[model samples]
Target: MHVKFLIIGAGPTGLGAAWRLAGHGENDFLVLERHAHVGGLAASFTDRAGFTWDVGGHVVFSHYGLFDRLLDELLGEAVLRHQRESWIRVAGTFVPYPFQNNIRRLPPELAWECVEGLLAAGRDAAAGVHPDAPAHFRAWIDRVFGPGIARLFMVPYNFKVWAHPAEAMSHRWIGERVSVVDAGRVIKNIIFGADDVAWGPNNTFSFPLRGGTGEIFRRLAARFADRIRLGAAVVSIDPAAKTVCTASGETITYGRLLSTGPLDRLVADQLVGAPPALIEAAGRLKHNGAFIHGLGFDGAPPDSRCWMYFPESDCPFYRVTNFHNYSPFNTPDPDGMRPRLRALMTETSFSGYKPEDPATLLDRTVAGLAATTLTAPDDAGRLVSTWEMAVDYAYPIPCLERDAALGLIQPALEAMGIFSRGRFGGWKYEVGNMDHSLMQGVEWADRMVAGSRETVYTL
Candidate 1:
């Protein structure tokens, strides 16, 4: 079979492209998804005990107006708006999100240490003692946040989340994702005893009222279900013939191909006759996997905070979300009547740099929760249902070699009528959020159908 446009992996990016193409009244496109269901990494699952959980801790927040309008149209009144109440667990206490901004919440001595380090960092900047540009993420953290915050939170927490050493990762991708705090603001907040909690774009976000985050994509996919081919994983791509072969022995020919799978696999494994340099470049692109655990309890939640970060090793998971708070329906009670069930979702990342034993992860996660004071020792007995998902491609690591690698691979693919744009496909963490991923596809479709210039997912 043949088509004008062919999309691989019916995740946010592929769905966005198909949706936009359909909106433009184009009908020659087909979406091929390996999974039987939609939503990709953004998919959700309902456990045996009726608790809903996302692959990871995904909140509905957008930097684009297009995404906002789409959400409004799709979810309508069936959505929940939340003021983000995120915190960090450290130094035997809970510090507000952006741990650098709330050092006062730490123990007095630790707070002073953080303050002193901030003062030292300020002095270094004033004196022009540090380099104009930090070499890597580690240097950037030390230069911007100083030693105390770096040692306590930035270094350890980042290592856990990314599963990569700070020195190996690039610092450039940290725009807006990280909060940069100065000494004066921190000191002033500490003096006033104020909580500097509202610093990021996700301070206020939205969620589906019934299903988990996956509900958004599920509803979108239903619009053109006839065009989507589930369980059809692409096995090979003959770029010269503009043909794709699926695992089911189906051969599809297309004028244009949009690949939302991993860039490395697209180049090194699937594409035919890929140049040696391009294949090597693809190999250099790094990524980490994630283990998501959804733990359901038979009692009320332990806290009011939306999610909490753990920099310490007491918890195998780097972050935990009070999933029940995202939506009451996330628990067993759809009517919001029974406040007895608690849903806690945890995310732990792993890569070659950091290995985890999946066999022992669940037990360690439960023990870690108690060790971090998220639950009591006896609460383990109250655990009614537990669900876990291991994602192979979770976060795309922004390593030092990423840009150079993309530089080599993306252009070659585009020249051959293949456009790869998404979290793993584009291999850019800065624009890898849900809104950005969808916009990348929309932009790609706009460019394809209307000669519109693509802005997001540019090399």
Candidate 2:
């Protein structure tokens, strides 16, 4: 099949690109999705008991005006807008989120130490002793919030998320994502004994009121009609000839290619020609996959908090989301007949330092849940339905080696008339949310069609 644009992956970004391309009256494109479903990592599934679960934890906080309009146009009034309430489980206490802002919750001794550090940092900032550029994530935190908060919340919490120490991550990506504690506020809070919660603009986010996030993609693909081919995985991409071969033995030639697949896997296949150094660096990009352990219960949502961060060492999973709180539709009606769980599913694999087993996984996640005090040990066994889904690409690990690696790979792909965009494609941890990913794909398509500059990937 000859097409103007050949896209891979039918997830939000892929579908968004296809939708935009079609809406622009440039409908000469075909999208190939490996999975039978439209949404890639955003795909949702129902347990035997009819409770729906997203791949991991996905909530929408639209960055662009166009995104909000598109969502409203497709899902109509079915989407639910919820107030986000997130916290962190630290030292056996549920600390309000943006923990740096809530240091009053810390024990008296720790709070004093943090305040001392912040006072020192405030003086330094006023004197302009810090460097103009932040070298690493740790330095960035320390300079902005002071050393004490960095040691307590920023350092440990980031370690849990990135699987690497803060020193290993670059600071160029920390803008707007990491909260910097204001010295004035910290001192005022210390005097007034106030806790800083609800510090960021993302306190309110939106989610589809029904059918999970995947519903957005499903409807988008439907709008595109036959342009999208589900269960059609691309086996190879020959950039020299501008053709892609699918697993189903179909060859598609296109004028432009916007690949949303992982850069490492894409180059490993040599489907498209990339520089040798880039391919080598692509191999060096390190990431740890995730196993989402979703539990459905027969009662009202557990807590108003949307998600909780785990910084302590005992828990295998870094963060757990009380996803039901995202929207009323996430869980079934409490008064309605809650179906008995028909089965329990557990998935396990090796990614990090130690290999995890399915049996051990069940125990670890359950125990972690209890350790974080999200659940009781006794209530662990009562989860009628539990699902453990292992996703190959979950949190993109921004290790010390990541920047150098992506630096080599991205330029190489750009030279081949291929734009590798989206979460895994760009491998950018910052701005790697659903909204950013969708814009990444759309921008790439726009860049190809109208010579518009890439917005999300420039950083």
Tens-digit lDDT track of model 1 for 150-256: 99999999999999999999999999999998999999999999999999999999999988999999999999999999999999999999999999999999998
Q: List TM-scores for all candidates, in order.
A: 0.99, 0.91
Candidate 2's displacement at residue 284, Å, is 3.1
Clashing pairs in 2: none
For all the candidates, what are their Cα RMSDs to the real structure?
A: 1.0, 3.0
Q: Which ten residues in a row have the lowest lDDT in candidate 2?
A: 340-349
Q: Taking the tens digit of each residue's C-alpha lDDT, what string does model 2 give over 49-116?
A: 65678887778787888888888888898877887777777766877888878777878888787888
Q: Model 1, stretches more than 4 Å misplaced?
A: 336-339
Candidate 2 ranges with C-alpha deviation above 4 Å: 126-134, 270-273, 299-302, 334-358
Task: TM-score for candidate 2, please give it.
Answer: 0.91
How well does candidate 2 score on lDDT at residue 389?
Answer: 81
